[model samples]
Target: MKKTLGIIGGMGPEASEVFYLKLTQATKAEKDQDHLNILLWSHADIPDRTASIEAGKTEELWAIMAKDVQMLKDCGCDYLAVPCNTSHVFQDRFNTMMGGHFISMIDEAAACAKTVGTTIGVLGTDGTRMNDLYGKALRRNGCTCVYPDKEDQEGVMHIIYDQIKKGQRGDLSLFLNICSHMKAKGCDAVILACTELSVLKNNYAELSDPWYLDAMDALVKTCVTTCGGIYQGNL
Candidate 1:
């Protein structure tokens, strides 16, 4: 029997769409009935993850997310997943509060990063960096987490905010340049730690250069398998 899966989405709508698409892509189903049960709560007004994290006002985040979880449970979801990476800063507390139903994207990404390299480069939003979300977990897994330098990081943010999130084509050269800089700095692989950056993998073919691993893809795999669906490995 497949367990119902619930998603706490809409931290950024595009990313959540990608998460849903990839979930279907990752599931090895011959027909519609073969797929796992999934419920997505994409509340349009869900608080901005970065803003709340930066302001250190995570209680509001907990309130909104917890309400969504309860709503999903009322609808019969057995396990929950939050596709947003920065949201994992509350994984520990939320797991404790919510009875450990949430599947963690950060831990899944860190595990994927471990398999990819001993020194991994991470690209994500400022809130994730501020909380050391991926960094701490990667370190715990014995992998060195490498981040972009100040200027390169700002460029990455521009691509995330001014480009993908806004439905524009991010500068391909700029993104590759950041990957090159990380590689030159000794990163065996780079993790696309932001969901918006994961959106880039569809636009830029070079993003599939084997030098990159998408955190969103990692979550899709874990979520699929955990929900009793066979992983299709399509990502």
Candidate 2:
């Protein structure tokens, strides 16, 4: 039987949309019924995750997410995927709160990276960087993780918030520069740890330098596999 995939999304609405689209693109469906069942709760009004974490107060954010998880469960979702990277810091708590229905995008991404190489570069928000969500998970799977310098990390934030999240076409040059820096640092591949950064995959076909493993893409694959569907590969 096919399982229903629940998405606790809208950390930034654009990223969630991309994730949903990826899920559709990744599935090998010849008919509408062949596609996996997806239930997306795009609560765009939820508090900013990075801001709450930086402020040292995650309780409100956790409460909102936990409530959403319960709602998805009540709606008959069999499995869950969260598109946001910073939100993965609350995976353990949310799992417990939701009685373990939550799927860890961080873990999925780490597992994917493990198959590719042992050394990876991470690109995301300040909260994701400070939390080391990707680093710790990848390390557990025997992969070493590297990150861009402070200045470059700021550039990443600018692209995510100032550009992508705001619905502007982000400057690909900024991303290329950071990927180049990570390559110079001996990273085998770079993980687009932030869902907001996942939007860059659209421009990836144009460049061939830094190989990227997108977290949202990993989550889409996980959703398909968990739902007993085959991933049709990247579009």
Candidate 3:
């Protein structure tokens, strides 16, 4: 029997769907039965995480996520995953609210990094940076996390918010520019801590060096593994 995957999405509608499509593509099974069962609540009404963090609306956002988690649990989802990086900020409380079995994007990303080295760079929203969410987790596991300065965080956030979230393929020039900056700062690899970064794989080659890690890819990998298969990257 296959386990049903529950997703709490619509932080931006497109990114949530991207995870589903990637998961289906990642499955190794040749037939429909081979693919993992999936159940998702693409609740676009959930308050925005970034907005709450920036505008002091955390209560509103957390309330919405808490309610969404309950909705998924009520739907009988065996295991749950949240694709958004910043949303993990409320994970602990949300886990309690949702009744646990939550798949963590940050924890998985950190484990992937720890296997290769001692330090890595994280690129994501101002909220993600301000909290050093992924960075702190990596450090707990003996991995150091390097984040961009305030201005750089703002730059990356703008690209994610203004461009990618709005459904525009982010300008590769700007993405590469950030990559180059991270490389210059001695980061061995870059973790696209934001799910919105999925748009970059459209143009960039993985072999372009300075290993580009996608958190969404790691999440998909985790989903496949949890559902009983090894996921080969569609990139």
Clash pairs, candidate 1, are none
Worst 10 residues of 3 by lDDT: 201-210
Best first by lDDT, ranked: 1, 2, 3
Task: Please say which candidate is ahead in lDDT: 2 or 3.
Answer: 2
Clash totals for all candidate models: 0, 0, 0
Best by lDDT: 1
lDDT on C-alpha atoms for all candidate structures: 0.86, 0.85, 0.80
Which rank order by TM-score, best down to worst?
Answer: 1, 2, 3
Tell me the spans in candidate 2 whose CA falls farther than 4 Å from its real position: 207-210
CA RMSD of all predictions: 1.4, 1.6, 2.0
lDDT of 1: 0.86
**Cα error of candidate 3 at position 117, Å:** 1.9
Better of 1 and 2 by lDDT: 1
For candidate 1, what is the TM-score? 0.95
